[model samples]
Structure formats: structure tokens, C-alpha cells
Target: MMNEIDLTKVDLEKPFMAGLMDGMPGGFFVYRGDETKKIIYANQKLLDIFDCDTWDEFVELTGGTFIGMVYARDRMIVHDYVRRARESGRTSGVTNYRIHTKKGVFKYVQNYANFVNDYVEGGLVYVFIAAARSTHDRLTGLPSMLNFLD
Candidate 1:
């Protein structure tokens, strides 16, 4: 088996990290672990998923926490998961939740976040890969029976 990676020892540059993250199958973003958890980097796919044409727009729209986009009922789940992961020193975890899109609609989203620290000048950062694959009615945003099949 491969040895566990020491996250503190990884020294990846932003350019290299971006190149790797951009090719991921879904949206990708990095956010600092501060009071706001400010967005530090967002890949092109993430911008498209958020209906943002540019990074600046995404930053302005999210107001630092992507948690703002989550459905109110599901927001706590995200927070709890993050808290648990941080406590356990986990490198990654998957969270499923709903997000309110800019088009005034909601989409079920799955987020895979990897925790990293000191990757840059920031303290702690989370790199998230997210995908929207809700088995809901495209029009109503309500879960269909088919959602169970997924």
C-alpha cells in the first residue's frame, strides 16, 4: 500500500495545482479556513457551475462562503461535516446537499473537499470538487422516485 501523504510536506505551486484541478470532472475551488473561508481559487468549471462568467464575479457573489449557496435546511449538514473532518484531521470527505443557483433554482450537489494547510500563505484551505446530479424534476427541483435509484 502507498504511504499516507503528509499534507504539510506537499509543496505545490498554484499554477501546478490549477492545472491539475482544472481537468477534474466537475467544479473545483479552494477556500481559506477563516471566519469567512474566503475563496482563494476557483477553476473554470466551478465558475460555469455557479453561473459566473469570471472569478471576480464568483467572489463577489458568494461573499466568501459557498455555504451561502446551500439550501438553508442543508447548510447545517455542510457545517457539521466540515467540523467533524477538521476534528479528525481528515484529508477528504464527500458531502451531499442542495444549492441555490443564480437562476433562482435549486440543484442537489455533491461536494468532495480535501483539507490542506499552508499550501500558500493562508492557514487552512479546502479544495472542493463539486457536481450537481440531482434526480429531481428539472422544472420543479423536487426529488423524483428515480432519485432513489441513483
Candidate 2:
């Protein structure tokens, strides 16, 4: 039901916002939609999900980029989806992809992304606020094929 949010106006660096992001569930993160897709923020849950022990380690491993965490075969598909969403001016959408974990595991997660236009360095760029959760049965702690299909 939510339509749009002017993320450019939201102070993402505010301590309160960062605190809220930390408490949120799933793997919450924000990244640029530019060619670099630079990751600006990543919550602790995201680090835990990726099996990274610390933020510095995670950044080092992925080179502070989101694409580096994507499974090789899924990069194009995921990138194209983001591109389409941005072009359509869609604020949010659902997506699924395999992510490479720091533990050398590939995890399939259902992801939700919200797009915001941010003006940085006098240029307008896209910022993506994303949340990802395992495509698994919570009770059983097992991969759920049904969830993946959805």
C-alpha cells in the first residue's frame, strides 16, 4: 500500500536510523544502483546471514559491493530486475537469488527491495533498501522448495 518515499531527504547516516536498521529482522542493507552498486549500509543480521564475523571482514570479502555476493550465474538476472524496477519507478518489488556466503555456502533468499533517488555529489543516483530472508521453513529449519517457487 505504500507508494513512494523520498529517500534523498532521509538522513541515512543518522544514528537513530542506523540503530533501527540494526534491530530489524532479515538481512537489511542499502546500496547504490549505479554500476558499482556500492553498499552503503549493512546490518548485523546481514553480516550474520552472510557468515561474516565482522563488518570489516565482510567489506573486505565483497570489496564493499553487493554484486560480489551474488552467485555468478544469477548476476545478470538480478541486475536486470533492479534495472527494470528503477526504469518503471517502482518503489518496491520482490526478488529471489542465490547469494554466496562467507562460509562458502550458497543460500537462496527471498528479497524485497525499495528504490529511492538520492542526490549525491551533485548527481542523482538510485539507492536500494533491501531485505532478504532465507527461502526456508522456519519451524523445520529446512529449505522450502515451495517458498523458492513463490
Candidate 3:
């Protein structure tokens, strides 16, 4: 069996981890766990997803917060999902939501997030986002039921 790596010993800011995150296929970001959910890091894919050319531009558009990155209409839903998950003692969660890009376009995305309570910054959430294609299911190529729902 392969050796299991200890997550607590891994430092996300380290060059190796940073490089891995940057090379990932989807959008990735890290944010504070507080109410503001202040964004600490965002990979290039995330900048592209938001239609931003630079980190400064992304931060400006999102107000450096996860809540600010979400489309206003969907913020409450996303918040409730995370809140409920955390309340139920979940350290991670996945949810689909909409985000308004800098170009004034709204895109549906699936967010996968893991909460780390022992981080140097108290609590932190690492997230990965991908376009939520309503045309087909992720595992199978069958039609997606989400397309028929609101």
C-alpha cells in the first residue's frame, strides 16, 4: 500500500504545493473562514473563470472575499449550504452556484471546499471550482437532471 501523507504537515504556501495548485486543471483558491471569507490565494484558472487578467483585478472585482465572488442572488444559498455542512461537523463540502464575472456574464460553477482549522491563520478553506455543465452528467454522459430544475 502507498504511504498516507499527513495533511497537517503540508504547507500550502510552500513552493511545491503552490506549484501543484497552479498546475491544477480547475480554478483553485484559499480563503479565510471568517464572515468576510477574505480571499488569500487564487490560481490563474480562477482568474480566467472570473475574466480577470491579473490578481489585482480579481481582488478588485471580488472585494477580496468569497461572498463577494458569488452572484448576489445565490449568496444566501451558498452560505446556507456551507453553514449547514459546518454545523453538521463536516470539514468539507461541495455545492453548485452561480458567479457573475467581471465581463458581466453569469456562470454556474461547482465548488469543492475543505476547511482546515489548524492553519496558521486560524481557520482556512481551500476550494476548487469548475464550470457546472448542465447539459450532461459528470460521471455518465447521460442528460443532466439539473438542467430541468431551477
Candidate 4:
């Protein structure tokens, strides 16, 4: 029989969780699930993705908010999508959008988010972000071979 670990007893700020987040390939972050959507935590990879050298710089660039991290043109659509998904009782979903980095370059990113109720924060969204690579040919707009293998 497998022993089930109790999440309620786990401390998220512990080294194990911190190390895991830091070692992850892509970016990971957590934000409040409120109108402000204030950022609570961000891994180093996330700072790199935003072309920021430190957490302070990242916060300054993004105004410490999730919506601020998104490209202005894509914010409304992304927000609507998340709201709709949550309203439909979905706990997690993926959103493809663009982000205006601190370097002023817009990069397409795929954001995977999980909506959960936290014991301390009430509502929170844990997110993983990665560069969005096209699985289709740009010119012909056809699916690539990698798509078929999946």
C-alpha cells in the first residue's frame, strides 16, 4: 500500500519545494485570485523569461501583478478566458498569450494555471509559463511531425 502524504502538513516555503521550483525547466509563479491578482511568488526562471535580473526588477516591470505581466493587447482576452474557465468549474487551464518583457520584446508564452483555495490566502493561482513554440509550419500553417507523434 502507498502512504498518502498530507498536504495540509506540508510547508510550501521549505527547501524541498523551493529547490523543486528553482530546478524546474520553465517559469513558475503564484498570484492572488482577486481583481488585483497580486503576485505572491516567482521563481528565477520567471525572472529570466521576463528579462529581469532580480525579483525586485521583475516586480517593478510587472507592477507586481499577473495582468501587468501580460502584453497589454492580450490582457482582456486572457482575463476573459480564465474567468470563463473558472466559472465553468474548471480547476486548471492553459492560456496562450504574449508578454511584453522588460526588454520591450513581446514573446508568445503558454501559461498553465491551477486555481485553488489556499488555507492562508483564500484563493490563489499557481502558474507555470513556458515559451510557446509553434508545432505548425509558419508558411504553410500545417501541423509538424511532432504533432503526429503525440
Candidate 5:
């Protein structure tokens, strides 16, 4: 599977679509460079969790213009983590994270992995974000704290 990921392509707009589709039940995601951190490819499950039907629409909504996703407070952490992962070829995962979707819904996204791109398909050492929105706050970006907040 690793052999199939191309890194040189760097087509942030739409990279690694085939691998992601082939690897089912897995969270295969890619974001464009220079921020807005536009989501490139997030498997079928990811789309269901976020309630989105298309990737192009997601890009149009989010735009490829920011450095990272997450609320302002958490952006730095994500940025630093992604940066380090790229430089060190590290792989890690975060549990119980609240991430926003293209439609403005927040879901529990558990991002993991840091496999460096092979420069054939243009993956910048992608990170796999496995997410589940079943019990997320959705509003405050918390985990089912809705009842308490309300």
C-alpha cells in the first residue's frame, strides 16, 4: 500500500483519491498547503460523519487558505504537531478531539499517523484522521456536553 502513495504530484487540490477509496474503513485524509487547510480526501465514513456529499463543495466552503483547521485556540497545536510530524517522519494519534466539518458541524475526529510521502502522488507525509461524530457536542465542539451547556 505504501508503494502506491505518490509524493511528487503535490496536487493539494485532489491528491491520493485512489488509495483512500481502496483503503476502506480507514481514515485517509489530505490537506492542501498554505493553509485554509482545505480537506482533500476523507473516505466515505468521514463524509458521513461530517454530513457532506462532495469534496469539491468542501473545498469551496473551506477554501485552501489557512494553515490549519480547528478553532483558533487549537490551531497552534495542530500546526505544530503536523509540522513536527513532517520533519521527523513521526506518527501519532489524538483521542477525543472535537473538529469542525464543512457544514459547520463539529465531530469527534481522532487523527493518527505520519507516513512521509514518497513524492510520486504528492503526499506531504499525510496524517490519517479517524473521526466519529456520534457523541460530539456539535455546537461547542465538545463531546456530548450539550445537555450540560444547555
Candidate 6:
């Protein structure tokens, strides 16, 4: 079936994605509507990244819109990628432009996400670790945990 969003239910209501979002390795955020993707839910880790303790402060970051916090150049790409995945009902992944955290300063991170479903309209998801750990050779950025020399 072609999954579609019912905008009426996807407005500024707090999405139904609180619990699952809390478990992601990095952080998670959920915004509603297009004009101002007003953040309805953001996991604690995300709040910690920005030192934000409340949803109201986070929502204001959008100036009121449903776009992600990724770099400007990446928004359209992310949107297109998400739309395609939603249409096919086949899961997809992306190398998202992630605004990351350093010791205290923020940096951009390349991350991945596997979508779950339309928590409202755009869909809720379990975002993965931004910089995944490698267990492989220093020679290559590959998983080597399964095979290594003693």
C-alpha cells in the first residue's frame, strides 16, 4: 500500500513517539507540520546536546517549521529521500547531515536513520549512532571484531 500522511493528525500535536525515541544511540527529534516543524518530541540526549531542557525552547529553533536541523544544503535531499522511502514501504537509510557535539562546542555529524512509521505524518524513527564504532583494522574502516589477530 502507498503510505500517506493525513495532515490533520500531523499538526503540532505531541507525536506518539516518546518511548521508542528515548532509546536511540545518539538522539532523536520529532516535528509536526511544514510551516514550522514545531518540535513535539525530542529525546533527552538531543536536549542534552543543545543544553535545552524544555520542548518550548527547542521548538523555537525552527522559527516554526517541520524541517530537520541538518545543514541547509541537506534539507531537500533528506526530504526527497524520506518521501521516496515512505512511498515504497520499503525501508531505506540515509547519510544525514548531523549537527554534532564536541567537548562543549557543536560540530556536524554524518548519521543514519531507519524510519518506523508515521508517528503522525512524517513518520517516527529510531535514529542510529552518528559515528558508529569500528572493530576492524586500523588499516581499513571496516568491522573487524569478528576476526582479529591475538
- lDDT for each residue of candidate 6 in 117-141, tens digit (9 for 90 to 100): 5754774554443543333444684
lDDT of 1 at 29: 74
Quote the positional error of residue 97 for candidate 1 in Å: 1.3
| Model 3 C-alpha lDDT per residue in residues 1-150, reported as the tens digit of each score | 999978779997788787878799999998999887999889989999999999999989989999999989889999899989989999998998778899998788999999998546889999999998654564785567866564
**lDDT (C-alpha, whole model) for all candidates:** 0.72, 0.73, 0.89, 0.90, 0.54, 0.54
Top lDDT: which candidate number? Answer: 4
lDDT for position 127 in model 4: 98
Q: Weakest 10 consecutive residues, lDDT, candidate 6?
A: 98-107
Ten residues in sequence with the least summed lDDT for candidate 3: 134-143
Report the candidate with higher TM-score, 2 versus 5. 2
User: What C-alpha RMSD separates each model from the true structure?
Assistant: 5.4, 6.7, 5.7, 4.3, 7.3, 9.5
Best TM-score among the predictions, by candidate number: 4
Scored by lDDT, model 5 comes in at 0.54
Model 5 misplaced regions, further than 4 Å: 1-23, 32-40, 64-69, 84-96, 121-123, 132-150
TM-score per candidate:
0.70, 0.70, 0.80, 0.81, 0.54, 0.49
- Over 4 Å off in model 1, which ranges? 1-20, 119-122, 135-150
Cα lDDT tens digits, model 4, 1-150, are 999978778788898788879899999999999898999999999999999999999999999999999989889999899989988999999988878898988787999999999898899999999999655554685665775565
What is the RMSD, in Å, between candidate 3 and the native fold over all Cα? 5.7
Inter-residue clash pairs, candidate 2 = none
